[model samples]
Target: MTRTVLVTGGSSGIGRAIAERFAADQAEVFITGRTPDTVERTAKELGVHGVACDAGDPGQVTALTARLDGLDVLVNAAGGLSQATSDDGSNLDALLAQWHAHLEQNLLTAVLTTASVQDRLTSGSSVISIGSIGAERRGGSYGAAKAALGAWNASLSAELAPKGVTCNVISAGFIDGTNFFHGQLSNERRRTLVEETHNKRSGTVDDIAQTAHFLASPGARHITGQTLHVNGGAFTTR
Candidate 1:
């Protein structure tokens, strides 16, 4: 039987790749983004349903999930680094803004979206959140939020495991493509990131996409409440 999948922030980058992976497998896929044009454009390109939504906003998340009947897979891929700024002239306020933005984008997006859609997840459903290697390193505020994501996933997995629904977090690192770096990475920085990895290479969007596909597959039914690192061994967890 065909499964239904939902991916947030699916207009481009890693999220789009995950949506495409599911669609290629004959799954009924729906994706959401904050912008109408971008979401519609991507849906047209991929032949999947797209909804305009800011997943961090409870109201938008509610409306987005209300459009779903039920889902076999839910991929919470919405997140980003906020701009560092002192635009408000208060240095402390600017710092707080950045931290709050990271928490909302990286952690709360997954939490709120999951809560909104829990009733729609059928048995054997899988909920996957996109985390970051930053959580283990010098990502600062963003890192803290991703770390909280792992903690939340642990709890969510425990709550859902008995129901045959699994929850996992894929903590990615040094991805080459996508707007993650916003085209501002220097060549030296790129080399440094790659060299930090055991594989001596940066990650691609497909790496995360394929992982999501498997986590939602029957093969991964026994795996939940875990953060599977996908950074080419950049950061190892015992």
Candidate 2:
């Protein structure tokens, strides 16, 4: 059976990898990005549908959801460290702006997108949100937002589980081949990140992509309201 999948922020990075993974399985995949050209290009390249949308915006999310009939998998992969800016250049204003951006991008994007598509999620469906290891330590505002994502997922899973829908967060660590650092990652930082991992290697987008695929599989139907860490043992839970 061909599953209908929607992946936000799928033009590149982990989202694109997940979309490609599903597309390979012959799933009907729809990918969204904030930019039209990128989304269209990636959709064409991947042989999937594409829509330009800012997932954080309620109206845009509503419009995006309208294009869907019933969804089998929804990957909320839209999130990143937002640059902080303020007109007055005041430290407090900058701080507030930074926090707001983090929450809006990393947290609210998932919340809004999921809520808008809640009714369309079929029974036995999955909601997979991309998270970060920064949520556990040294994650500042960005981490806090991801942490909030996990918390929200817990509640969301509880609510959706009774309806046969599973929701979970994938807390990823130092993945390579993505513009995650916006070209600001130094060699020293890169080495340190790999060294901190038990595997002694940076994660690949396929790592997270595989995990997302599994979570949406029949085997993972029992798994819900969980935070699955894909950081190569960078962080652990008992």
Candidate 3:
């Protein structure tokens, strides 16, 4: 049977790849983005349904999930680093803005989306949130938010597991096709990132996509409340 899959931030990058993976499997996929044109274009290109919704906004999330009949999988891929502020500004205010933006984009987006769809998630449903290696190694507000996402996933998994719903976080590292670097990744930085990986290569979108597909599959029914690191052994977890 075809499954209903919802992916936020499906307009591009890892989210787009994940949506394509599901569509290739003939799943009924629904993608959302904050922009109408981007979401519509992506949905049309991928032959999936598109909705314009900001995952950071509670009301938009509520309305978005209300349109769903039910969900087999929900992928919270709607997050990223915020734009850096000018150093010319007051350090304290700039830091505060950055922190607030990071929390809203990385943490609150997933939290609000999951909360909105919690009731719609039936037994056997899977909830996957995208995390980052930054959460483990880097020191920044964005990393902190991603860390919070993992913590929240642990609790959410415990809450949903009893009802047969599984929740997990995929902590990705140095993915190639995303706007993660925001065009600031110099050749030296790129080489450094690759050298740090055991495989000596940057991660592809397919890596995360396939992992998500597996987590939502029947084989992974027993896995819940876990953060699966997919960073080419760049960061190991005990």
Candidate 4:
């Protein structure tokens, strides 16, 4: 039987890579993005369905969920940190605004999307949330939100495990390709990041995409509520 998959923020970056992976496997793939043009262009290029929806907004998420049914995989990949996304990040009020924006963009997006599509998921479905290594180190507001994501995933796993659904988070490291850094990464910083990794090389979007694919496969059914770190040993765990 053909599987049905949904990936949010799939117009570019890691999300796009994950969508392409699913499409290549001959699954019925659906991707969503905040912009119509990019979503349409990506859908046309990848031969998959695309919808214009801001996953961070509750109403848009509701609409997007309504369009999905019998979903086998839900990849929550819509999240990012913009320096100017909120009030100034220095002042107290600005700090509050920044924190709220990060939580809304990173945490709330996945929560709202999964809650809306809970019933539509099949028995063996998988929910993969994209996370960041910042959660384990000094990422500030974004890190805090990602840490909360891991916390939430643990609870979600408990609630879904009995129903045979697996939920997990992928804590990605300094992945090089794509528009993630938005062209602000300097050569010095790039070298510093590469040096921090044990592999002495930057990561690629396909690395995370491949891991997401494995988590959704039958072999990963026994794995739930786990945070799989993919940072090339930049940070080690006990």
Candidate 5:
């Protein structure tokens, strides 16, 4: 059976890798990005449907959901460090702007998107939200938002589990070859990240991609409402 899968922020990085993984399995994949050209180019290259959308916007999310005809998998991979700025020139204003951006991009994006498409998700459906290791450490506003994502997923899973739908968060760490750092990652930082990992290597997008694929698979149906850490021992949990 061909599964209908949607991945937000799929133009590049982790989202794109997840989309490609699904596409390789012959799933009917749909990808979205904030930029039309990037979305189009990725869609063309991956041979999947593409939509330009700011997932954080309610109107845009509604519009995006209208294009879907019942979804099997929804991956909320549309989050990162916010680039929002405040022109008010005050510390409080700047702080508020930064926090808002983080919440909008990382937390609200998943919340709104999932709610808008809730009706489309049915039995055997899976909702996977991308998370961060910072949620357990000094993530500041970004971490707080990700931590909120996990909390929301817990509640979401409980609500949806009775309907045979599963929701979970994939808390990733130090993935290479992504714009998560916006080209600001220095060699020292990179080496330190690797050294902190038990495997002594930076994570690849495929690591998270494979995890997403599995969570949407039958084997993972029994595993819902859980935050699965994929940081290669950068953080541990009992």
Candidate 6:
């Protein structure tokens, strides 16, 4: 049977890859983005449904959720670094703006979107969030927000598990082919990042996409409230 999956931030990067992967499995996929052009373009390119909605906005999320019925999977993939900047490019005000943007972009987006779709989720549905390795180190404001996502996922999983719903976060590392670098990653920095990975390579969008597919699969039904690290051993606890 085909499942209906909703992937936010599906216009590009990890989210787009995830949507494409699911669509390849013949799943009925719906993706959302903050912009109309990108969302529409991605949907057309990937052959998935695309909607315009900002995950950070509660009202928009509510409307987006209302449009989705019988959701089998929900992936919170919309996230990014801060766009707000200071004139000097360094200051307390800039730092504060960055923090707020990260919080809203990462944390609030997932929270609002999940809340809006909670009731619409089927019993065996899974909710996945895209996280970052920075949550473990060098993440800064974005990391803090991602850390919160893990903590929240624990509680969310506990709450949803009894109802046969699973919630988890995928902490990704050194992902390439995305705007994540913001075009600022120097060659040396890029090399250093790849060298840090046990695989000695940067991660591809398909890596995370496949993992998301596995987590949402029936075989992964027992897995919930867990943070699955897919960093090629970049930062391992053991």
* Residue-level lDDT tens digits of model 1 in 4-91: 9999999899999999999999899999999999999999999999999999999999988889888899999999887776334468
Give the higher-lDDT candidate: 2 or 4: 2
Cand. 4 Cα-lDDT: 0.92
Which residue pairs in candidate 2 have backbone atoms (N, alpha carbon, C) closer than 3 angstroms, thus clashing? none
Clashes of each: 0, 0, 0, 0, 0, 0
**How are the candidates ranked when ordered by lDDT, highest leading?**
5, 2, 1, 3, 4, 6
Q: Worst 10-residue stretch by lDDT in candidate 2? A: 81-90
lDDT of 5 by residue, 56-123 (tens): 99999999999999999999999998766632446887888889999999999999999999999999
Tell me the tens digit of each residue's lDDT in model 3 across 1-238.
8899999999999999999999999999999999999999999999999999999998899899889888999999998988867324469888788888888988899989988888889999999999999999864788889999999999999999999999999999999998987999899999998999998999999999999999999999999999999999889878
Q: In model 1, which regions exceed 4 Å deviation? A: 86-90
Model 6 RMSD, rounded to 1 decimal: 1.7
User: Which residue pairs clash in candidate 5?
Assistant: none
Assess candidate 3 and give its TM-score to the true structure: 0.97
- Model 1: lDDT equals 0.93
Tell me the tens digit of each residue's lDDT in model 4 across 79-160.
9875644444558787788898889889999999999999998789999999999999888888899999999999999999
RMSD of each: 1.8, 1.9, 1.5, 1.4, 1.9, 1.7
Residue 9 error, candidate 4, Å: 0.9
What are the per-residue Cα lDDT tens digits for candidate 2 across 121-213?
979899999999999999988899999999999999999999999999999999998998889899999999999999899999999999999
For model 5, where is the 10-residue window of minimal lDDT? 82-91
Candidate 6 positional error at 46, Å: 0.9
Q: Write down the TM-score of every candidate.
A: 0.97, 0.97, 0.97, 0.96, 0.97, 0.96
After superposing candidate 2 on the true structure, give the runs of residues whose Cα lies further than 4 Å from its correct spot: 85-90
